[model samples]
Target: MAHEPAVIAALDVARPLVVDLGYGARPDTTVEMAGRLRRVAPDLEMVGLEIDPARVVDPRDGVRFAVGGFEMAGLRPRVVRAFNVLRQYDETEVDAAWSRLRAALSPGGVIVEGTCDEIGRRCTWVLLDVAGPVSLTLCWAPEHSERPSDLAERLPKALIHRNVPGEKIHDLLTLADQCWDIAAPLAPYGPRVRWRHAQDLLRERGVDCVVTRRRMSDNVLTVPWEAVAP
Candidate 1:
């Protein structure tokens, strides 16, 4: 949230309401998200929603717990973080799910929907606004990923099956892996340095990427949705 300008702007609204959809049986992640977002919007409200009523627990640490799903529990929120939810549904159902979530958003709202490994070493998510998906972001621990394309297993449902020959996503990942190999000379400096050099190579090849201001602990790649649209 702190790194994305659109997300920060969404939370800066007069009455910012953020929802952690499908926050699982434990509320630990929601609580952590609340703490992190409070730095950007101290007055922002947070709620953790789960489809299973039994999973919803007592509110704690300023985060309300409730039973809800893609409809957002009838509450219009400014920001929604829905990780590992759609991965359970069929690819054909993804559009409907996204539409339902978009309909429940407040004006200028945004949604971060994605999937990640159990320990979150690799993640891929799509950033969406009222109109539709804006960009796709891939994040991974440098040591956990052999090549940028290795994170392909973590792609969200929408594009998970689209990573095939002739697909834009496939092309992007292939190009990224090629760049990683080309940057092998920098590997002696460490994975982080080599990954940064690989990213530089990506840009040099005319792939538009979101530039980060400071050194990041993980390798991240973000490109506009059009670049990988199926």
Candidate 2:
């Protein structure tokens, strides 16, 4: 749910929405995403693209499938959600993959890429406008930890291996944790309340953050990539 809203939102403005570079083996998740997006953007047409031709399924309805990588999906879509496919890829190759995905967008479209823990409880993703990476989104269940720093454990592929000292991501997450500590008294009010208040403080203090009440309700927070990168 890290970006279910954003995805639905994008589909509202663009047509022939599709998800490229999905995981190789699972059709179930693709099916789920197709239905969810269709519900919000009734005119949407989703195509699940995969590198393995055989893994791609020519599904029965609303959703379609193609055998290809980000490089040549033979499609132009409004949105593409590529999750967990790059954790195994070297960090240096990320930009190229993104370039290819962005190439498939129709004018003002997007490529939402990121990583997530299985079962979808904790996750992080990046939103790539046709131009390039614009924002990084973090999603998790507040029930996992009373402190906001717990999100650091679910870093997306780009920041996952960069959580060491001297890295920007490390600083952002650590500082967030420190702020969470100072706001601990709010914990008595509840994680959601404390999180909301803490996020508000960060914004007032000039943190470049913009989040919806919906995202907050979904237990997510986001920062620009420059704010938290190695």
lDDT of each: 0.92, 0.73
**Candidate 2, which segments miss by more than 4 Å at Cα?**
1-9, 214-217
- Model 2 earns a TM-score of 0.88
Pairing residues by index, what is the TM-score of model 1?
Answer: 0.97
Candidate 1, pairs of clashing residues = none
Give the Å error, residue 26, model 1: 1.2
The residue-level lDDT of candidate 1 at 19 comes to: 96
| Backbone clash count for every predicted candidate, in the order shown | 0, 0
Model 2 weakest lDDT span, ten residues long: 1-10
**Residues 26-141, candidate 1, lDDT per residue (tens digit)?**
88989999999999999999999999999999989999999999999999999999999998899999999999999999999999999989878998999999999999999999
CA error at residue 209 for candidate 2, angstroms: 1.3
Error of 2 at 43 (Å): 1.4
- Model 2 shows how many backbone clashes? 0
Residue by residue across 90-204, what tens digits does model 2's lDDT show? Answer: 9888888888888878866777798777877777888888878778777777776555556666676777788888997777677667766767788888777777777777777
Q: Each candidate: RMSD to true structure? A: 1.0, 2.4
Off by over 4 Å in 1: none
